[model samples]
Structure formats: structure tokens, C-alpha cells
Target: MDAGLLAWGRAVKRRGGKIPPLWYFTDAARLADPLPVIRRLPRGLCGVVFRHDTAPGRLALGRRIAALCRERRLYLVVAGDARLAATLHAGLHLRGGRRGVLRLPCLVTASVHNAVELARARRAGAMLLFISPVNATKSHAGAQVLGAAGWRRLARLAPRGHRAALGGIDGRSIRALGQGCAAAGAIEAFYFNV
Candidate 1:
């Protein structure tokens, strides 16, 4: 993990509350085994978005991750699975354009790639929005990048203290983003050298 990126993640926060500045987003293909990485994350004010959507035995894997988060005091959000999240008593992370309504009382987050998605997430009652493609990323190689300016534009549309920078976010890029984002989420940044 880059010390600069970690520092940036730790320092950025909303005015009213301290959202976990650093978010570890798990990928089934890239980060098959996330336990070791999760263990290495700095405790407190850090979050894990477990996104093993199609992997076999995902529920079992989520349970393990959830256990680690509890032990390490890391916030855990199971992506795309309300039942599993509820079972583990963890938060929920919705994918692109998904509605976020849930009866369970948990931290609800969503991914937004454009203005429409951003508006939808807010209406669905997502507490945080992970704005993506801030820069070119291997995960979405050909995807259009938001760059610094575009990201700021979309982030500005989000509710204050509820926007998180995602996609190709690293120490250098995040520094460029300044205070536009309340938090930052990454899959490769935390697992591999970026």
C-alpha cells in the first residue's frame, strides 16, 4: 500500500461525520483471496466492499470477510446481496444504477457512472456514492475516463459528504482530486502496486 494514498484516504472526510476515507473494494477475478489484504488494512475508519458476485461459495467467503472485518474493526459491505449482508449484519453496496431501498438498518452505498445514476442512488437512499472511472483503469480498460475535472463535476452533483472517488484512484490522482470526494475506494490500489 502506498503511504501517500493511505494518508490521503485517512485525511479526507465529510464535515458532519467521518466516513471511512479508505475503502477496499474486493474483486473476484483480480483479488481472489482478500483475507490477507483485509488483515493488512489499517484498523478503524477503513471499509471493505466484498464483491464476489458470481464466485462460487460467495456467502461462505463473505462470512469469513465479515468475521475479519469485525475482528479488525473494519466496516464491511457485501455488494449486491441484501440477504447476505443482513445475515452477516453488514452494510450493502449496490452496483451501477441499482435501487438502494432496504428495510435493514445498515450503511447503504451505490456506484454511479453518470448524472442519472447519481440521481437514482440519492433517491434510493444511498448514504454514499462511489463515482467511477475517475481515470483510466485496467478493470475497465476502454471505458471513458472522468479525469479530474469531470469527476469534480459529477461529485459536485452528489449530496455533500456522500461522494467517494473510485476507478484508477491512487495516491497521485487522489491528490489531484483535492477535496472533491469525501472518500476513496480501490480494488487494485490496495492489492497491487499502482
Candidate 2:
């Protein structure tokens, strides 16, 4: 199978109307035993996103994650490094910078928190768009939250089929988005906070 298609197919399968539970581990220490937690997740647990935090052995750990995903038939997303993603088997998720990178037609995702960012993601031709701050986040204390209604509205502004919710998302809220999600076409995934 095509590596890119396989990755995208897995993404769609995980997110398609099912409102899969996604866990993003921004903490560096979690990588030591992420697989054990990942393997035990229910069907809703689709995958994980590894954020950049100046940790050690990230590349090696990311490579290990790629191996786990390949072995388990699960998905692994690497944020902020298109080159690294392209090199590894895991999918690429672009959050901030988008220059000097060649589009690989892989399951590429971008962060879109507002109308301007959404438009920029569309222009960048991202396969999936991640909209965040849907609820008040403990990590980002005092940050504005988009809430459900705001998320739906922002998603509508994006291109026809390309949007996913992020930031302050929990299992319960994800269930709600799965039920009456407004961005019907674009929201193929929910990168939730687990």
C-alpha cells in the first residue's frame, strides 16, 4: 500500500464520525513508556502527537514510536518537523512554520485557531486542519477558548474538507463533537487532550 495513503486512510478511519480519542503528550518524560498506555487504549484511542519541547533523544524516541505504529497499525503524528516526518513512517503535522518544506502529499495536518489561520492552512493545502482552544485549558491558563459553537463556526470558514478540533478537549467533549459536529466534511479527526 502507498505509505501516504495508508497513513491518511488510518487517520480517516480513526476520525470518521467516530470521534476517536487522541492523546498528545507534550511532556518529554512520557515518551519512555508511551506504548504501554497506547496499547491499552480502547477503540476510540486512535493515536498520539509528539510536541517539540527541547527534550533529549526525541529523534530516537520518535523513531521508536514510528516502529510501534507500524507494528500496531496505529497512527503517529510528528508535530513541527516536516522533514523528520517525511523521513520517518509517522505522519506529519505542521503547526507553525510552513516555509522551505516540500509538500509530500502525505497525511499532512496544520494548526488553525482562527479565520486567518484557517485561510492560511487552506492556502498551504494542508490535508487536515487542527483547530484548538475549544475549551479553557489548564496548561494555557487564562487563554481564550473557542468552545463548541465557535469551533464549528471557524471550521466552516476553512476549505470544503479540512478541519479538526484541538486544545482543551476531553473525552466527554469529544463525544459531543462526534455527535453533532458542524464541520461535517472537513473534521475528519479530533486530536483531543487525553
Candidate 3:
């Protein structure tokens, strides 16, 4: 974690409120080694969603990340890997429209790109939803993005109230969300030393 990020996390952690809905999604392509960043992140201020299931030795790495999360008082969610989620007693992350049920002790969250996906995630009992492309992003280069106004419209569709705006979201974009639009979740910006 960058010193600024750690300071930000620690400052936010001191709020003594509900866990911040902000999340950090891990991507191997974004950062070859994310452990240092993960280890340095502020606990209780951000959730870490491990999503490198296809990478070599992913299971072992996931286990290690889960353990680090536990030790640092950070919540971990295993993306698209129910078995790992279960084994680590962590939350499960599902892609948009990926249907699944989680047993007790495991919370469920999903990524949504539109109102339909938002509705699907809500109906699927997702406690939190990650809605993306608040601005142009590298991952989906040249793709249509949901600007602030569009995001606000789609945000109304989230009944569960725990949603984060991701994808090319910078400080300015977050301010543009206005009041109650959503929280901020990031991948490259949050974890890749960008």
C-alpha cells in the first residue's frame, strides 16, 4: 500500500462506523505481486476480493491472501470460487448474472453493469454490488461508459443499498456521484500503484 493509501485507510477506519463499502479487486495482470499492497492496506476500511482464479498456484495464493486478510482485520471475498470461499470462511463474489446460493457464514456479492444485472444481483441476495464504468477504463477500452448521470439512474435500481461505483473512477468521478450515489471500489487505482 502507498503511504497515502495507508493514511487514507487509517483515517477512514477511525470513523467507527459500519465497514466501508469500498472494495479492492485483485488482478494479476494489473500487478504481478499484490501481497505487499494487500498487506499494507488499511484494515476495516476496504474489502479485498481475490479474483485471480486462473493464475498458476491460485489456490495456494488465495489461501495466503485469505489468511492475510484475517490477520489484518480485512474482509476477503473469493471471486467465482465457491470452494475457496467456503474453505476460507470468506465471502463469495459472482459475476453479473451468475446465479448461486451461499451457505451460512458466507456473504455474497456481485458485479453489475446495468439495471438488469443490478436486479439479478439483488434478487440473488447479494449484500453488495459492484457497478462499474463510471468513466472510461483501460479494461474495457472504447466501451460505452456510464457517466455520473447514468450511474445515478442505475443506482436507483439497487434496493439493497450496498453498491460501489468502479471502473475508471477517480477522485473527481467520485465527487461527481453527488450524495448517496454509491461507494468507490477500485482495482488498478487502489492496488496496482497507479
The model with the greatest lDDT is: 1
How far residue 148's Cα lies from its native spot in candidate 1, in Å, is 0.7
Query: Local distance difference test, per candidate?
Result: 0.84, 0.56, 0.73
Answer with 1 or 3, whichever has the higher TM-score: 1
Which residue pairs show backbone clashes in model 1?
Answer: none
* Residue 110 shift from truth in candidate 1, angstroms: 0.8
| Clash pairs detected, candidate 2 | 162-186
**Each candidate's clash count:** 0, 1, 0
**Candidate 3, superposed: residue stretches over 4 Å from native:** 1-17, 101-104, 192-194
Per-residue lDDT, model 1, residue 119, is 89
Comparing 2 with 3 on lDDT, the higher-scoring candidate is 3
- Sort order, lDDT high to low: 1, 3, 2
Per-residue C-alpha lDDT of model 2 across residues 1-194, encoded as one tens digit per residue: 12332244345555554323243444444334455544543343355665644667778867777777666655566777777777776666666425216666566566667887677666776656777777776545697888888887877776534556666554445434543332211111221222
In candidate 1, which residue ranges exceed 4 Å CA deviation? 13-16, 192-194
TM-score computed on alpha carbons, candidate 3 = 0.86
Report the Cα lDDT for residue 11, model 1: 70
Clashing pairs in 3: none
List the candidates ranked by TM-score, beginning with the highest: 1, 3, 2
